[model samples]
Target: MSEQAQQTSNSYRSGPDERGHFGIYGGRYVAETLMPLILSVEKAYKDIEDDPSFWSEFYTLARDYIGRPSPLYLAQAMTKHLGGAKIYFKRDELNHTGAHKINNCLGQILLAKRMGKTRIIAETGAGQHGVATATVCALFDMPCTIFMGATDIERQKPNVFRMKLLGADIRAVTSGAGTLKDAMNEALRDWVSHVDDTFYIIGTAAGPHPYPAMVRDFQSVIGNEVREQITEREGRLPDTLIACIGGGSNAIGLFHPFLDDPGVAMIGVEAAGYGLDTGQHAASLSGGKPGVLHGNRTYLLQNEDGQITEAHSISAGLDYPGIGPEHSWLHDSGRVSYAAVTDDEALEAFQLCSKIEGIIPALEPSHALAHVMKIAPDLPADHVLVMNMCGRGDKDIFTVADKLGVTL
Candidate 1:
């Protein structure tokens, strides 16, 4: 694509300018104390970003350890039911640790090791990232500490157990609604205090400069593999791509490689807890305005006074007040369309996917599935739609059961 076409098409192939601003959405907005460390991280990551040996190790780990090339399977049952678009699932849920989180974890752990960091720290909402971080830390023989919201720890007990089993020290964050945002706050405090030895592995594509770009690059493996697999299967790119947007790691992963493919449309689903009008949803792009949070300027769920508000979602993973800056940029540039789904809608889609595809998807992607269920039936039968089933439902069974009033 020519430079003019790239710029006009909103392909956004080049982004996060030298100072880390993604069209004013992403930048290193940090305290002086954390600036040096963040710059060090940026330098370390940039050094390896082009290193063949670094990628070789990352690829080897992704294939042998985390299980790469997650399949893109056509969901025939879902397609027939929708009777319009042929739905295909990018099955990253089958990956090690049962989520796409491990992909970035492996990449960052390798970076941490290269930096001679001896301790690993991370913040998680749904616990998937925590478990992924703990798993890599265990593999690398590094001491791991995970900060999780107390409410998340309660609702996502299975993941909590998994993180503990992986030998991680789980710290419950009890501030500000006791959810992902609070957990991130605690993790940042820990990192700032222990900058000498701790490497903070942020779960999502949001954070300071290198983090959003770094996590998105690591997770882009999902999109890279999708491009190859779908080309082999359909002989061309799909008509549209769909994925849930929490901190947008999975969605960005699946969307990045296809950014320049103007023919392929992209959609990101956010948790619209009750509804956008209810003031209880987490649909950041849909209901939020841009503001600085977690060291980056992005669309944030904040009140008129600029205080961040608690986000509501059935899935703990999607209950975040802000999104990754890249997602904010994409939304603003109109490169990617953003939509919202309600808790009930996601739950219904969750059960429908379970019954039809025999895949019990984690609630996060179920939000995407909800949108797919809505639009697929309206599109042409020949139309193709790909959705990222980013994580398995095993960790969410208890929460689902409680909502359904079932004894697990």
Candidate 2:
């Protein structure tokens, strides 16, 4: 990568256009009350992006405080059995609070302060993002409220306790399926009710317009580091980059910077509960049609009428009916190949990685691992593959243990 090339890439890294639309997929979709604040945020971000000093400071915070440029470790043992391409784990699991959600949380907290917003609110499922948001809110000494589904609060009890300890007020949403999307709806309702001073820190890259764009920009550190590190380690960009799509944030972040790289292959794996054929799946791309849901025009697992269907997946995180708009565009443009993984297959991979690599991956990444099991056995030996392990599995112990017929 020459200086000229690097400059060109960075120039388009956050853009091919601003105003937060990614090829007509993303734009600011907000109520009248938030229009001014959203615009102000857009302007402030543009100003900050232009300031090199701000980036220097932000980079310092990322490296020293948040512990970033997270390691891209070669899964030597896993790859040896899978045969072909060397496997690399972009270990976002190593980040604070056991997931990559911290990257965006910290960045959002900083942006909220820059915009003079004092209170922060967000939605969470599995409580990973909630914990991350609570952690940052604690660090910033800001009032934080997290709306989580009642079911998640029950299942992910440890994380809920963690959030309370971090001083976040947890609101349990009981309507709908009592899961991630339900919590999102309640969170959105809260935002609409209190649109004055509260900043909505959306956990994923799925929300309307600027949020998906903003979060992706903040999380692009994964791709930025991958490009540099892979070039040094394997002497080139990876042939295939994979990440699990739960609201599509992490996948979009890692894939966005590499989209224009023609030689790079990208994959987004969604959760397939029982199986797509069984109609009990969260395979949004495979089992869904394009529809408007949760503010973005994206593929959603909807029914005959307009009502959103219940999403089912063993992986609590990927159990959503809709994906981010950018993912919908990527699917339409053929920029990304999307696939589904069965709950059974995911569990197998979850156990396999634990036994082999000594890594306990979140069920979300287990879907990606399921795909890797199939894809790796076929690719050339020298081909390289990288997958983002988005989280750890401590929050999933009860579910996994029961599924395996074990008792505490």
- Top candidate (TM-score): 1
Q: Estimate, for each residue in 1-408, the C-alpha lDDT of model 1 and write its tens digit.
A: 233322323548677778888877889888788999999999999999999999999999999998888889999999999899999999999999999999999999999999999999999999999999999999999999999999999888888998999999999999999999999999999999999998999999999999999999999999999999988999999999999998999999999999988899999999999999999999999999999999999999999999999999999999999999999888877889999999999999999999989999999999999999999999998898999999999988888898999997
Model 2 scores what on Cα lDDT?
0.85
Reference-based TM-score, model 1: 0.97
Off by over 4 Å in 1: 1-11
**lDDT: worst 10-residue window of model 2:** 1-10
- Could you tally the backbone clashes for each prediction? 0, 1
Tens digits of per-residue lDDT for model 2, 1-408 = 223322134433443246555555666666776677677767777777777876786788888877888999999999998998789999988888988888888888888888888899999998989999999999889999999989888888989999999999999999998999999988888877776788889999887767777788888888888999999998889999999987888898899889888899999999989999999999888989877766666788998897899899887788788888778767766768998889999999999999999999998899899899989988888989999998888888888998999997
By lDDT, who's the top model here? 1
lDDT for model 1, please. Answer: 0.93
Candidate 1 C-alpha error for residue 121, in Å = 0.4
| lDDT to native, each model | 0.93, 0.85
State in Å the error of residue 309, model 2. Answer: 1.1
* Residue runs of model 2 more than 4 Å from their true location after superposition: 1-19
